[model samples]
Target: MAGNMFGRLFGKPKEEVSPLSTLEKLNETLEMLEKKENLMQKKIAQEMEKAKEFTRAKNKRAAIQCLKRKKLYEQQVEQLANNQLRIQDQMIMLESAKVTTETVDALRSGAQAMRAQLKTTKIDDVDKTMDEINESTEDMKAIQEALANPVGGMAEFDDDDLLTELEELEGQELDEQLLAPSTAAPATHLPSVPTARVPAQAGKAQPVRTEEDDELAALQAEMAL
Candidate 1:
């Protein structure tokens, strides 16, 4: 709908002039008018100079005639300037219209392309594709998890049963350690007092003797007999 409007605004019959060609023609006319205006300005200045010279010579009639021609040239220059302004205004309007039409046409083309893409793609189709991908990903994850699990009948083993077996083995080891006998030698007791002693001097106390001293005294008595 918007494209139609722009086409109607910018389109022209073969007999009608296009905006570009019209702008060119206006530019040429403006240049020509400018040249004519410049020429007229120069002519006006020349007439003023002529009028000054005539006035210096005391020729009032010739000076008056030169002044009248200068006024006419000024009037023509003003008219040319007004014409140039009008042409410039027309060119600006045409260029603005052209720009607006081009902008709308670009927007219309983009809108059409977007609509085509929308038609070719559907929301349901997109959802289904995503769902398939998700399912495939989940299947892959399951396969990976299965592959990562323990192999060779290990997965069938029970954690509780293994712990019970380990506890029994530890118990048996503790029992064996408790039943074992120590291999260390027996310890002997030593008496603090001696079993026999020899008499000392009357002023001194008698010295105590150990069992080894008694054995030695018996051995000496046997040897003397």
Candidate 2:
């Protein structure tokens, strides 16, 4: 097929050609036609100037021939313009088609890559990996919290037993207070002295009373003589 296209482009009749090759040929032809049109425009201008000079010199036959040549150049320029327009239109359409083809090929390649990735990796594997990551993160957080905590700070004790012990101590303190005054020893009573006395002569020695009374009595603060 490529051989046929090449043959078609180079006039070999048996070769095929690519689309890019066809567009390149059209561009070359358009450029050549544009150059021809420019040359024909120059020729038309020259012929018109020549016709004006001949008319001024009163040469009727030469002026008519120059006018005829100018008309022929004008017709050729019109034909080249039309051909260039057609080739430009063809190039625009071909370029648009090439861009679209490339875009579709890119999308096809991306889809194939996605299919290959899906074949290698599964949804179950993704879910398992995410679950493992979450578990590992939670474990790390627990380790960090343990490191930041004070040692033996959360040790538990029996609150009811502690309250019972405190109540026993309070009861012992109350019993000690209630028995305080009764623990003292009792006071002993003794016999009282008699108020009667015998007066003697000034020269005589006083008698000593060493004997106690037969009965004991409570003494008053003030005693009568």
Candidate 3:
């Protein structure tokens, strides 16, 4: 029997009920309860009026009976009010739950989108791409530098060979300097003293042999040699 009951319970597919529809139902229930409570209040008032009439007619039992009926109506009205409060509370909870559900769903969607985006690119792939870019940049720079260089492969010169050639030139210069004439001043030509000099007075003292006269004599003697 239990198996049959469970089968029956699970046989029908559950209907999808939206929070809005549920809230509307709760609101309707609340309205009905409010109306019923208002009617009960009216009945209580009528009972009170009837009780008053019985008291005026001196019918104690009828008056007591009316009061009892009034008490029972009051209890039902209180119960209806409680039911309204419970329905309002349920509506508030449903509203809060609806907002929470939507927020959670939005967060879940965002997470899924982020996951999909991440799937498109991996860290290893990114690193490899960056390495390729860097390598390409370096290669491009090398090409540019090669293009900017002078066309002839001979643009580059060996420092050691250049220094050796400089040394050879310096040796040549030294040889030239050594083969040049000495750095002495040439003798100055002066007007030969008048060859037709008047004879000196026989008695005049001979001219003194000054150092300059000696130098002149030595120079003339050498030239004559």
Q: Which candidate has the top score in TM-score? A: 2
CA lDDT, every prediction?
0.89, 0.86, 0.89
* Per-residue lDDT of model 2, residues 77-139, tens digit only: 999999999999999999999899899999999999999999999999999999999999999
lDDT of 1 by residue, 88-114 (tens): 999899999999989999999999999
TM of each candidate vs. truth: 0.58, 0.59, 0.50
Better of 2 and 3 by lDDT: 3
**Model 3 bad stretches (over 4 Å):** 1-10, 121-225
- Backbone clash tally for model 1? 1
Residue pairs in candidate 1 whose N, alpha carbon or C atoms collide under 3 angstroms: 194-209
Instruction: Report how far residue 66 has shifted in candidate 3, in Å.
Output: 1.4
Of candidates 3 and 1, the better by TM-score: 1
TM-score of 3: 0.50
Better of 1 and 2 by TM-score: 2
Order of candidate numbers by TM-score, starting with the best: 2, 1, 3
